[model samples]
Target: MASNAFRKELYVFERGPEGKPVMAVIRNYTERDFDGLIRIQQESFPPPFPSELWWTKEQLANHVHLFPEGALCVEIDGEPAASITGLVVDFDPSHAEHTWEEITDAGYIRNHKPDGNTLYIVDVSVRPMYRKLGLGKWLMQSMYEVVVQLKLERLLGGGRLPGYHEHADTMTAVQYAEAVLAGELRDPVMSFLLRCGRTPVKLVAGYLEDEDSLNYAMLMEWKNPFIR
Candidate 1:
């Protein structure tokens, strides 16, 4: 229940107390925005989902009218620049085997809180050239403000390292694993989370024998009043 004023005002990004034109605003996704979202995802993620999987008229219909609550897009001058998909889930740090759906469906995470609740942030991506400009961090803060208006308790994100296979010059799976082990690996989205005061509590390894490499899945958490 973010205030109408806050939601409306969120479109602008802050740059050292000055509003910059490069700011991104969060809005509901539309069919026209799908292609850009897909392109950004393809470039940002390894093994991205095929464009056909998501860029469909049917998907657009569902996203706009149905589950649009957590489907958010950040736009620059009304053009999509970044996007995120988040869902509130029951967080069970102990259940390593449970998929995201299972945890939420089982009521391990409560949708309605007797008091304060939590906002479980899912996927987030910013267009490559736009990195480090604070768009990602601003979007996250906007979500936090939304949760606060709704009196939610916390925020969370599933962090992952991009895993790829080498066909020629690339080291493929081995490089992915090495990066995970060496601590040289980092997820840009997760790094944004850290700048906003999140702590990584768990790391799940992503491995593909065919590629012969390993990736990583990290779990990060942040509570309200991010600055304490």
Candidate 2:
């Protein structure tokens, strides 16, 4: 955590002329534009899910204020173009063994443990059509503001990672975790974070399973005080 004064500041710039990107502070989940959010999620993800699974207005309203402090949305010309969702949850080192669902519901942060000191970035997705325009960087900067405001010491959770166990039919979870963490291959999400001045705090061993699965976990924490 940095100085409270430094953390509370906001940095604004015109991203475009007529289509200026609006950096809307997301206070409640209902304020999240589900249509745009779902589009970005689907376009950025494989094994695309039905829109109804996540895009319902009821779901948004139900969880909108749960993490109201850290959620944010980036709008383009009055339309939501990108969104970043996170929370100031306690981090439990023991939860490393927990399933994603378990972590999602009863994880360290959700349980309000005293040892949970890190900020949890749940989802950071930008529309595929809006890639390479610095929107991701902008959203990340916004996330920094939220973290600084909460005075959190570290960040944790599964960021985007490389494809898993592509060539192998069966492999140990530890082996797959090592491959991704050791940089056996390039990961676009990790690369993006690095480019935006974020570095890994720890690459947890046995953090992910490798069994013809496509998703792998990437745990990164912000080191610098100012990514604003």
Best by lDDT: 1
Q: Per-candidate TM vs. native?
A: 0.62, 0.66
Q: What lDDT does each candidate get? A: 0.55, 0.54
- Which residue pairs overlap in candidate 1's backbone? 90-109, 117-153, 166-172, 173-213, 174-213
Residue-wise C-alpha lDDT for candidate 2, range 195-228, written one tens digit per residue: 6667655444334443334545556667436433
Taking the tens digit of each residue's C-alpha lDDT, what string does model 1 give over 1-228?
Answer: 222433333544445666565545676666677788777676665454444433344544444443355557777776777776555544555754433444333222334222434566545778776664666777677777756755556677655443432322565433554454466664444444667777766655541112322344456777776434
Lowest-scoring 10 consecutive residues by lDDT in candidate 1?
207-216
| Deviation in Å, model 1, residue 78 alpha carbon | 2.3
TM value for model 1: 0.62
State how far residue 77 of model 1 sits from its true place (Å): 2.3
* Model 2 segments more than 4 A misplaced: 1-32, 46-55, 93-95, 106-116, 164-184, 201-215, 223-228
